[model samples]
Structure formats: C-alpha cells, structure tokens
Target: MTARSTQNKRKRFDPVLLLVLLLIVFLTGLLVQVILATDYLGSGLGDDVARFQDLSGVESPVTAVLLNFRGYDTLLEVMVLLMAVVGVWSLTRAPFPKKPIEPGPIQLAVVRLLAPLMVLFSFYLVWQGSHLAGGAFQGGAVLGGACVLMLVSELPWLKNISSRFLRIGLLSGPLVFLGVAILCIVLQGTLLDYPQEWVGTLLLLIETACAVSIGLTLACLFAGGRPKDDLSGGRKR
Candidate 1:
C-alpha cells in the first residue's frame, strides 16, 4: 500500500531542482564562452559595460550585429513562435464560435485611428531594419497588433478566413526565409548573404512579406477560424 501511494503521488514543485537546472545551463554556456572568448562589446549600460563613447568609431553595430552576427538566435526565436501555433492547434479545437475580445471605449477609439498609422510605421521600421533601428521581427509584431485590434472590435473583420489559410500564414515566414537562404547558398557562397544592391531590397521584401503573414496569423489566432462568411465586406457594426 505504501509503495503504491508513493508511485501515485503527484510531483510537487521543487525549487532546488529548478536551481540545479539553471546552474547546469549557465555552466554549459560558460564553458563555451571560456573556450571561444569571442564577443562583441554589445553589452549595454549595465555594470562593467562599455558606453556609446567607448563604442565610438564603429558604425551602427547593434543593427549590423543583430541581422548578421546574431541572425541564428533570431531565426530560432521565429521557430519557437511557429511551434507555438502548432501547439495551440493541437491543444484547442479551433473555429469554435468566438465572442469579440472587446475593448473599452477610449481604447477602442484610439486603436481604431492608430491601426493604419501603426501599419505604416511598421513598414517604415522594417525598411530601416537593413540600416537602422527595426527589422522583420519588429515589423511583424506591429502588424500582429493591428490584427489584434480587429479581433477585439465589436465587429470582427475576419469572418471568412479558413483554417487552411491560417496554416499557410503560420508557415509562410519560415518557408520564405528558408527559400531565400537556400537561394543565396546556391547563387553565392553563403546562406542569406545579401548580394550587391540586393541587401536592402531583399531585407525590405522579406520584412514586407513577414508583416502580412504575421497579420494573417494573428487574425486567425484571434478569430479561431475556419470562418464561413465573406469577411472582405467587413464594416463596423
């Protein structure tokens, strides 16, 4: 009876176990750092960190490092998000009738006006991503917000999106990125290495495509849809 009880007992939260796991992760990464010793002075305003004055003479290292040096980490982040979509689909039976998420009056009015401007702003940011502050991920996030606003409205705008289309949207970002990477490898010596004059153009194109796909993904997530009606004719109710 005692053996059976122990076997059937629920696993309790163990802080010691959590700490040991974290220690293992830190130690593994620390060993890699010790072996490589390779770093950019990208550490910020925190303690023992170099300031902008210290980092002078270098061009916009943040932007360059993000898109170039840290590209793999960013790529993995996108993958994690893609996986979340699959997890959600598997966990929930979607296209169940939805109630609008609903917003307060002032919030609703603000979102109504800001939505279009935000989209334009996101595009501008993505355009600048190749050189300046933003990139495909940031642009996609803003586009996602626009879709959220629509879903939260008293009148939903996405009444016709099929789940199949949503599945497409979810996969689009990775597929496009993979295609570009493969193309670059075939045409050039490296994957996703921008050719002459093609750097900004390619980045902008990818960002634009990502923004729309993100919007669609957000819309589908919020709508829970394989919607039945024509949503193209959507108007405020």
Candidate 2:
C-alpha cells in the first residue's frame, strides 16, 4: 500500500504546474513590494517644464518636452517603430484579402468622403500640437485610420502603390529628425540644440515628418507585412 501511494504521488506531480504556481507567487510578492514603495505625493517635472517653456519655443509644454528637451528619447522611439515594421515585413507578407469583395456604393462613398477629411484633420492636429493637446502621434493615428478605411474599401490605387514610395515615407521621419540633430551639432556644438530663432520652425518640421512616417508605419503594421507588389517586383501576382 505504501509503495502504491508513493507511485500515485509521483504520477500526480507536474513540474510545469509547480513552476507556474511559483511564478504567480513571485509576481504577487513583487506587486506587494511595489505597492509598499509607492510615493503618491511625489511631485513630477511639470514645474521644471513650465519654467523653461519659453526657451523651448513651443507654446505647449508637452511639445517642448517631446520635440525639444527630450528629443533623443523621441528619436529612439521613432526608430523603434521603424524597426518593428521592418521586422514584421521580414517575417511575413501582407495577407491581403484573396477574393476582393466589391464594396457597396455607400461604403465607397463614405470612405472617399472621410479619407480626404481625415487627411486634412491629421495635419490640422499636427499644426495644433505647438499650442494645443494634439501632436504627431495623434495626427498619425488619424491618418492611419484613414488609410485603413481606404484599404477596407478596396481603393484601386492602394493596391498599386509602389514599395519605393512606401520606403520613402517610412524613412522620412527618422531621416529628417537625424538630419536636424546633425545640423544642430554643426551649428551649436550639441545634438538637437536648436538656435533660438529656428526652434519653432525646426519643431514644426520634425512634427510634420514624424507624423507622415508614423502614419505610414501604423498603416503598414495593420496591413501585417510587405505589400504583394513589393514581393512580386511591382507585378500583380
């Protein structure tokens, strides 16, 4: 009976289950530790940002921080996004619908009307970033949504869009950003240190370029991979 009971215990043992339980316990303890260490009353960098907002050139403190004070971080973020899309493209081809469904007239009309308005609104958001809450990411999101709408509507032009143009759009933001940084180094002996007179202009340029790239990036991600035209050397498969 003793031997039989030991054999049953061995049969019931699961290393994977034990590991999962241990992981859950470890995570719970870490969460508790984080809770204990929380400082709810700690003041953040809002005051410092406001103190130097004028020097930063943009009317919006958030824009000043993102495009000016912490520009390096923003640069890395854009590169990361580009790398993500590149990685996705390398791993898989875009799985566009094989049987192209004829979109209804109403759907087509809605998309045609909305797409142009969205494009206009996206730039408007970019323009607002300097003085208001909207910025590149928000504008880019709107633009991406517009692309998605057109794609779903099966716009013929989108199917034939050249990979070359896509590549240019994807690279525009980071290239412009890095170019500006290099130019700043030449002019001011520091990376991204814009001349006072050029600060506003430089910020707008960066925002515009970044918005375009970001929109393309998001749209490409939604498409899930490289276009079929790119894979087939610009010929329809």
Candidate 3:
C-alpha cells in the first residue's frame, strides 16, 4: 500500500509547475513576436517632446514628462508611497532598539559628517533636476539613506522626533500635489495644467515637497512601524 501511494504521488504532475511553464512559454513567444516587429530606426516621441520642452518649465525631458506631461501618474506614485507607509504602520510598531547602543567614535564621526553632507547633496539633486538628470526621487533616496545612517547609529534625537512632524512630512507631498492639481482645475479647467508663466515655479514647488515626503516615507518604512506617539491609546511599550 505504501509503495502504491508513493507511485501515485510520483505520477501526479504539479499543477503550479505546469502553469508556470505555460506562462514562460507564452511570454517567450510574445517577446519573440515583439522583437520581430521592432522599429530600431524610429525617432519616437523625441521630436514631439522637444517641440514642447520649453513650455515644460524644466530642461530635462524626463523630468518634464514625469512632473508635467504626466503629472497625474507621478501624483499617484507619491500617494502609493504614502499608502505603503500607512499600511506598514497599521500592521506593526516600529522595532526601535529598546536599549540604545553607543556607537564607536569613528562611526559617530562618520555619521555626523556624512549625514549633513548627504542632505545637502540631496537638495542639490533636487535643484539640478530642473536642468539635468537628477530629480525628486533621486534626492529623496539620498535623504532616506542619510536617515538610515543616523538610525543605524542610534541617534537619540531621531527617536524623539515628534509624531506630528513625521505625519506632516509624510503627507506634505501628496497634499501639495493634489492641491496644485485642484488649483489648476479651478484656474484653467484642467488638472495639473500649470499656467505658462508659473509652470517652472509650480514644478519646482511640487518637486521640493515630494522630495521631503518621499524621504520621510522611506525613513518610516525603514523604521518598520509607527512612531510611539502615533500608537493607539498613547501607549508606549
């Protein structure tokens, strides 16, 4: 009976494995078809973007597309980051170290030096984004890296950060973006359609706010939960 059971089990193919194999084969065929239908010599939308690039308020085509041409998509992406942090906070409390560990002099020195510099560099990236390859996401990533460095060093001040401040930082990006969109609708009867004269300023404003929020959101995600003050019933464990 045991031998029969083993044989039957061995003979049964895994449905999941079969499904995965089918999917792989389908995708491979689709990829081949797409490759065969490729237009390698196409200029694509470069000319269209260039023709309107001056009106985008930023010299970088990528930035113009991300923050101006398709601002709604960027708005949704920022909201997604905020929602991710909210979901994480809802699920668990930040796993902060109960007992703070003192860092070595070298580690402390490095963090102190690099954290500030990284912050400055992040802002520079935000500024450069207007005319170059840098932008809010890159700047925010750098800022988040700096925060992670401080967290790893177990900075006492970081633990004491007010929940209100954190919440404000996390919400600022989406709120500002939504506000701009609504304002555009009110003024121009279209969402995110900045006035020609104000396009540059508005894009900058959005990028700055988004960079700050993205930085905070990323840091909060790294912390893995809500700050103590944000806990229910004002409880702290």
Candidate 4:
C-alpha cells in the first residue's frame, strides 16, 4: 500500500511538463535577447527623445512618458493597487484590530506633530513631479505613512470615523482613473490620451486624484483590514 501511494504521488509530478515549460521560457528569453542585440527596428528608444520633446506643455519627460505616452501602463499600475486593496478587503472579515493597541504619550505626540509635516511634504512631492523627481506614488507613500501613524496611535477620531468615507477613499483612485480613461477614449480616439491644449491640466488632475486614492489604499493595507464605523463612541482627547 505504501509503494502504491508513493507511485500515485510520483504520477502527480509531471517532470516532462516542467522541463518543457522551462525550455519554452529559456527559448523565449533567448529570442528576445537576440532580437534586441540585432537592434529591433520597432524599439521605442530611437524616437523617445524626439517624442518627449514634441509632447506639448509637459515639463518632465518621465511624467510625460508615464501619464501621456504610456498612460495605459500607469492606469494598469493604479488598477493593481486597487486590486490589492480589494483582495485584502475580500479576504478579511474583522475590520480593524480586535484588541486596540494603546500608544504611549510620546508616540502619540510625535505622530501629531509629524503627520502634518509629512502631508505638506507629500503635496510638494506630488506637485514637483511635473518638473522634478517626485510623483503620485511618492506622495501617496508619505500620505499613507501619515494615515498609518494615525491608526497606530489609535486616535479617537480615526477609530470613530465612518466606513462609508473609508470605502470612498479606497475606491477613489481606480474609479477616477477608469473614468478618465473612458473619457479620453470618447474624445481622443484612444485610452488615456489627453487633448494637446489640456495636457497639463488633465494630467495634473489625474495625478492628484491618483495620489489621494493611493494614500488611502496603502493606509488600509497597513491596517490589514477595513475600518468599521462607530457612531456611538465619542472622540477621545
């Protein structure tokens, strides 16, 4: 019986299929490298600099690439973040921690002082992304850190906040991105393509919305679950 069981387990291990898959992956990678080495004619690097210059009204080439030239990529990245938060929500039942962790006075005080500073810096980072080395993701991380701080401190207001607002905050990025993509398709004949004249305004708006949504989503992720509303509990001092 033991020998039969071992044979059954061995039957489940498809070594041939595994080897075939490995060989296919290796060949695919090798093909790509060979094409790249031969200087593929369709490569984007050749005209990227010229395209970057012609994309009107945008100061940052990086931003232009992310939000304009390859917007679908950015849109997909935002969707990934949204999906992560959604997956977390789906798997979790108990919103918020069962036992509240009480932070000490110094920790609470530090969070109080640092939260606003981080928020201000995050905004700067988001705004500067158009001209320099910051963007929505960086700003969102700072903002998310602030939210995490608030949660870690177990602030009264945070604990008592409405779930409805939380849900809105979490879903805000994906919804806005999807709406913008659809609107672009209607007006520009392609997804995420902005009108030449309105490139700055539209991209800025999208980035701002994305930053906010990313912030909320990340905070929720750190919390490990959704927050529940407690209308009856008054704010603590």
Best by TM-score: 3
Error of 1 at 44 (Å): 9.7
lDDT of 3 at 153: 87
- Model 1 C-alpha lDDT versus the unseen true structure: 0.61
Q: CA shift at 171, candidate 2, in angstroms?
A: 1.0
Put down candidate 1 lDDT per residue, 1-237, tens digits, no spaces. 123334546864466766888999999999998868856575553333224312222123454454444545655666677776665555444453456555678887887798889889878777777556676667777888877776666445455456566667777776776676677788787876656456545545555666666666665566553345423244322
lDDT of 1 at 68: 42
Using lDDT as the measure, which candidate wins? Answer: 3
- The lDDT values for all models are 0.61, 0.89, 0.91, 0.77
Where is model 4 more than 4 Å wrong at Cα?
A: 1-47, 54-56, 94-101, 229-237
Q: Which is the better candidate, 1 or 2, if ranked by TM-score?
A: 2
TM-score of each: 0.60, 0.87, 0.90, 0.74
Worst 10 residues of 1 by lDDT: 49-58
As for TM-score, the candidate ahead, 3 or 4, is 3
Residue 203 shift from truth in candidate 1, angstroms: 2.0
Q: What does candidate 4 score on TM? A: 0.74
Tens-place lDDT digits, model 3, residues 125-179: 9999999999999999999999999988898778778889999999999999999
User: Across residues 96-176, which tens digit of lDDT does each residue of candidate 2 receive?
Assistant: 776677889999989989999999999999999999998888999999999988887887667668889999999999999
Runs with alpha carbons beyond 4 Å of true place in candidate 1 = 1-60, 94-111, 215-237
Per-residue alpha-carbon lDDT of model 4 for 99-169, expressed as tens digits? 67777889988998999999998888889988887878888999999988887788766756677887787
Pairs of residues clashing in candidate 1: none
